[model samples]
Structure formats: C-alpha cells, structure tokens
Target: MRTSRALASPAPSPQEIGRAATLALHDELALSPKPGLVTLTDRGSHADMDAHTFMRSLFALRSYFVRIAELGAAQAPFEALEACGIAAEARMLAATQGINTHRGAIFMLGLLCASAGSLAARGLRPTVDGLRHTLTQRWGEALARRALRPSALPGGQAASRLGLRSASAEAALAFPTLFETAVPALRAARSRGLASGPARLDTLFATMAVLDDCNLAHRGGLAGLRFAQGCARDFIAAGGAGRPDGLAAAAALGAEFVARNLSPGGAADTLAAACWLDRLG
Candidate 1:
C-alpha cells in the first residue's frame, strides 16, 4: 500500500474514481487462469456467460459508479445509494440479457466508489482507512438493517442455506475480507517484486482459501466449497504464484474447478475491489 504522504495530492473527481472501479472489474476479467471464473480467454465454470458478457455489463455500468459517488459526496442517505445500486443492477442484467455478470461488483465496488467520493468531497484523499471509515460512518446502520432482510439472490439464498456469511453481512461489517485479506495479499505480493499478474493470482488464491464463496456453494454445495478452499490452501502452502510452476498450477486448478462446476465469484469480486483500491493510491 502507498503511504499517506503519497495520497496527499488532490482528491480524484467522482468520474475518475468511477472509471477506476470499471477498470478494476476489467482487470479481474483480463486476468487469466482464474479458478472457476470467467476470463477474457475462457468461461471457467459458467457456460451461460463469458468475457464478452462481462464487457457489455461493464459498459452498461460506466455511469452508475459516478452517480453513486456523487450521491455519496453529498452525504446522501443510504436509501439513495441503494436506489442507485438497484438501477445499476437492472442495467447490468439488461446489458447481459439477464446474465449476472457483475452483480457482486455492483454492490461491492459501487460502495467503495461512493466512499471514495465521500472522502474527496470532504477534501481528503482516499486511503484504505478513509474509504472504510466513510462507508461505515455514512451508512453502517442502514447496511445492518439491509442484512436482516432475507436475500432473494441465488448466492445469498445459498449462503443462508449453508449458514455462511452473505455479501450483505460482509457489507454491514464494512467488508473485512476486502480490507483484511485481499488488499493485504495483493500489496504484499507486489511489495515482494511480483508482477501484476502473479500478484493478482496470489491474491485470488489467498482470498479463495478463506472466503465462504456462496457461488461455489450454490453450484457445488458445501463439499465443493471445502474442496476449493483446500486446493487454494495447498496452492498457498506451495508458495502461491511465486514458484516457477505457479501459472501451470493455477491453470490446473482452473481446469479442476471447471470440471466440478464451482465458481468462487465472491472472491473474484473481492479481488476486483482490491484492484480498485490499489488504483486509488
């Protein structure tokens, strides 16, 4: 992570912050060898959607982040942010012809961009701490109330069935996994001189090892989720993407995930959020 000194420059405009969020989603899509997830080259575990589907969704959502950010800059109530997100999700579904390419990103990265806007409006540059603080301070109670409602989304329903933490729960807690796990893993890998691809790969695997990915559970059930986590843990135990054969190992893992029809979409969303935060600095 960059120091606060590095972040002392003028805060980015809402449009710039929104653009970074879109690019971060693109970055996640362009990353190859993602276990059980869509990439530019292949549809990992999903047959319904591919990289093109994701691109169209991203294009549709280009303005949404900015709108949400503007609302956040004004310190608008949580209802306003939720309404923006609901509309964005509709646009994403329309763009992908009802395919859910970026639903998770819509919620997670949208909130982050809004937090960034909040900081900028307050004449502060975005730091991880600042972003988290803004999000919680501005809408923590609303998020908690939102979490109490039964989720209708497939992933959230699956999480409920399995007694796993839903995405809303993570949000209400201010996305501990994004700040505590994914961002740190990405930064540590980069600080160790790893390239972007390897660093992201490391972060993905690290995230998978711990995240109770509802997508995986929805597709493959509890057993499948455990299997995926075990694979990720083993990958990290073997030095993650730092080893010479790391890419090959990741490719093999991707193949295995496909065969089992498991997708760690939650972890992928977290990785994209981490990428967006990295860009903010």
Candidate 2:
C-alpha cells in the first residue's frame, strides 16, 4: 500500500500541471456509463450539454489550470487564486453557452493544480499527500471561510437545503472524498488487475455511493440523491466492473439516470480528481 506521502519529487511545472488537468478531464470524458454524467457515447442525464460541449469547455479552461499553477508556485493569496477560478468559470460558461459543464471541476481540480504549484515552490514532490498538505496547510482556513459564504449556484443552495456537504466544505477539508474514497477506489481496482476503464468505473461508483452530490439534489431533491447513491452502492456490491454483467448493468443505470434527470456532477469531479492524482504519480 502507498502511504499518504508516497514518493517525493520536485514540484511540477505549470506545463506539467496543465497537461495533467487536461488529461484528467479527458479521462473522465472517456469513461462510459458513468451513471448520470456526460461521456462520448451520450450526455448521461444532462439535456443541455453533450460530449462536444464538454470538449469545448475543456479546451476553454485548459489554460486556466496552468495559470493557476503558476499562481500557486508564486504563493499567491487565496482571493487572487479565486479570481482566476471566477474567470475560468466565465470562460466555461461562455464556451457552453451558460451551461455548467465543469464548475465543480474548476473548483476542485483548479485548487489541486494550485496546491501542486505550492508544493513545487516549497521543494516538495507533487505527490498525493503533498497536494493535500499544500491545500490545507496554505489555504485550508481560507477555504473554510469560503464555505461559510452563500453560493448562488443551485447545487450549493440545494446542498444547504438538504443539509448535505457543499463543494466548499469539501475544499475546506482538502477533499476527504478524493483522498479517502476516490483515490483508494481507483487504486484498489487497479490492484485487482482491472484495466484502466474498469478501474475508473469502479472509482466513479465508489464516489457516487458516498458523496453528497449537490447536482443530484438540485435536480431531484433528497430523493434523487438517495436514488443515485443506492444505484452506486448496488453496483459496487454486485462486483462493479469486475463482473461480466457489470458493464451492462451500468449501462442500464445510465439509461435510468437520464430518464430521471439525475446527474452526479460532484462524483464526476472527484473521479477526475482521482485521475489527476494518479497521473501526477
């Protein structure tokens, strides 16, 4: 088993961070039957966005990760870092025509990029533990303050109404879901000798089963969130992608989610986070 520290190396360059972010987003897009998320074959549960829209959004925000990484390497203040996020969000909206394709990712992955930068600056290797440590050590308090601020996004509002953990709370805690659940799930599947696609599928299901995804609640309320979690839990319990019928079962779930108009964007974001961390190592 890999410890939190893992291996230490020099901080990654801005270009490295940018490449990792882009590939991570691509990995997420490539995963199929992600149960309520967009992919190459279909738009999952979303009607307004498609795979092409996600491609555009990814292209638009590709540079933001690099620039934010530079800021992190420079040790910029949290507000300045957030300003970059706001700009990136606007760019994403512009590309998707006001659609929220990657808002959750912009916050979660963007911070990880910045944290990687900070780690590089401090002469630490950009390992999983390093990124998490930099995020909490350097900006954890600021993230906590941001969590207290009200958000205008429906997901944030819905999370509050449902008494669920908001995205802000996840960031403030340096992403417990990513570190504690998503990453481990990915590693576990790989250790079991599963292929990349299967590993990622299992990882996504693991996150969905536990995460208090605001997007699900925003669209379907608490009932919606519970439904998504149950689906994910059942999938995992049924051997996930390891079973011969797993892919078929997941495809069925995807159809069901689209019909129900439920999307687990939060889980998708964490899945991407896991991809990013794996790539870094």
Best by lDDT: 1
TM-score of each: 0.97, 0.95
As a whole number from 0 to 100, the lDDT of residue 220 in candidate 2 is 94
How displaced is residue 197 in candidate 1, in Å? 0.4
> Model 2, 87-196: lDDT tens per residue?
99999999989998899999999999999888877666577677788888889899999999998989999988889999999999889999999999999999999999
Please report how far candidate 1 places residue 12 from its true position, in Å: 1.1
- Tens digits of per-residue lDDT for model 1 on 146-211? 988999988899999999999999999999999999999999999999999999999999999999
TM-score, cand. 2 vs. native: 0.95
Clashing pairs in 1: none
Clash count of each predicted structure: 0, 2
**Global lDDT of each candidate:** 0.92, 0.91
Off by over 4 Å in 1: 1-8
